[model samples]
Target: MFTVIEEQEQRLLEIRRALHRHPELAYQEKQTSALIGKELDRLGISYAAGLAGGTGIRAELGKGTGPCVALRADMDALPVLEETGLDFASQQSGVMHACGHDGHTAMLLGAAELLARSTVLDEIGGRAALLFQPAEEAGNGAEAMIADNCLQDVEMIFCGHIDTHHPVGHLAVDQGLICSYADPFLIEICGRGGHAARPHEAVDAVVVGASLVLNIQTMVSRMINPARPGVITVGRIAAGAVHNVIAGRAVLEGTIRSTHPDTREQIIRRMQGVVRGLEEMCRAEISFTLHRGLPAVVNDPVSCALARQAAREVVGADQVISQGFPSLGGEDFSFYQQKIPGTMIRFGAAKDPSAGPAHSGSFDFDEKVLACGSRWLATVAVYGLRYLQKS
Candidate 1:
């Protein structure tokens, strides 16, 4: 086997197309996991299947010597209809790789191949752990994996997502706070149901829900610090079914997010207090449900420097730039960064220059970046392992 995996650039693209053709949704990546496991076995890398999270695969290259540097790639697809019209488009109807996870999986797999074939990696270096995780789009995958001891031997971890907004072959990230904390919340209001015409007879839950929304807006704007950043979006609202009847219950579903955990908690508490007050004033019952998706993802300073150095080697120095703005999007990789001094970077994967954006039905990324993504990840794993050993 040749170091650098001579035909890896081609392998990345081909694997991406294959995964695209057979996309699967979160927690149901049996075919995807099996395919990756087979490839890892073929490379002769020692691996463990069904560990850390739903259908996750872990493979280690080189002898168990120095601290391991982990590279992560999420394997779950999204619940969107494929309309890209590419030849290798998703075969699974109503489930597609709309989030570019297919690209991530392919890139990490390429890195694995490169590391496996590298004589330097096997003889003179430490181990590089390639993590193929499932269900990252849902945001619980990282934590579930950690709970199962995925990061036990990992001293540092790095993960990346394909961003449509950034240019191809470009990478962006802040030294800290790369992504936001995503917390889902729900509001339920119950009141008396009666004839629509009799205004005094019924406490309409629909009216109360409407008032609650307005109050929530006020709370976010007035109670939250103006300088601090946060988002309060109501994604769904349901109430009355018939036109003439007063509904007894109304439900509101939304999410809260922030760059800081304290800020996230403060905003959530204030939102609940506001909803409680509204229910009390309207004489209605209220309920809440929360599914904490991910905590904020922060990049370690030392890791950031290492990434920039690694990227600059693959691309020019001018191509590597520090990102000032932090994204409000959530990532399960946050769980890894929590314990390990990890850094999550962004890679350009947009397909069409005229493309609208990612996560849409027409989501796509340029296939050329596959080569760059693989090379960068492989180089980083190699360099990072060496860097750790030096320390």
Candidate 2:
């Protein structure tokens, strides 16, 4: 199976580099979608473009009679500027493939090419649906694809993400809680403006906002159960315009993350209670808004076992690590799991310790993992489909 990917490794690298050079953001993946369509066309793979009511793509390869398995790759880039200094760095200003969606898209395309070859689909005994998803970073792509029936007739699904924290040959395949639920929030505090030197003349929104931030932090440490892990962070705050004037209004924006749904709900409820208390204590009005993001990525046991088996076959059993800590970061892949049994694996792509972390300006990895990822994705899709059909 790897030999197929190895044979097309150079072409895969070229495709990846080309995608890196022209990074697009969120739903604005026009060029990226076009490139994917062009590759699928060249490979003789039949596909439908403009899925999810936007620049998403879906392709299938195999006899249409058997169970179908879906493989997904996000096709969006971050807003970070390029600093990798690679010859194939981003050509667009203030946009870069800093989170490795470029590699994900390239590998999925390679998998489609390999799976669509003659006799491959027949041997697998089922069909493979390739999902080229957009706007994962902005967090609505999976929902949109689901709305577009991306998971129609799919029995099981598989996806993978490139992880720089792991070594180049390792694969992380935990059976539960791979990622956290992300909920973004905004808090607005309205108060009276006055001179900064006046101690008791007016209501100070800066003070109220500062208090609210600290109290919200305690929602995790004190309010929530110690056994349940949760996080609340205030990433941005805006208030007074002048140095000597007390702020009339202050806005706070941040994210909340949790591994459990109940914990997520608990934290939000506690946060609202805290805000209410602070508003009364400070004699001010406050408004809170929660933009519910993606859910925690919990792997289905059967699909996870299939993914592990595929990873061992593609790489080696020794290179497959089944136990790892769940990350606080959120993945929109979780949304797919809500509709069908699916698992998302982590492919090791870390090649340089000096390179910056994911979402950073100087992030990069060895291109060798591209072939590994492609093989793994293709193999897992086949294995998952066969398993689901038998079950």
RMSD of every prediction: 2.2, 1.5
Give the candidate number with the greatest TM-score.
2
lDDT of 2 by residue, 40-91 (tens): 9998888889988579998988875889999999999999998988999999
The TM-score of candidate 1 is 0.94
Per-residue error at 304 for model 1, in Å? 1.3
RMSD score of candidate 1 (Å)? 2.2
**Model 2 misplaced stretches (Cα beyond 4 Å):** 5-7
Deviation of model 1 at 75, angstroms: 0.7
TM-score (all chains, Cα) for each model: 0.94, 0.96
Error of 1 at 257 (Å): 1.0
Summarize candidate 1's per-residue lDDT along 194-299 as a digit string, tens digits: 8999957998999998887888788778777866678878889999989999999899998887887777888888877877887789888988777776888888
User: What do the candidate models score in CA lDDT, each in turn?
Assistant: 0.82, 0.89
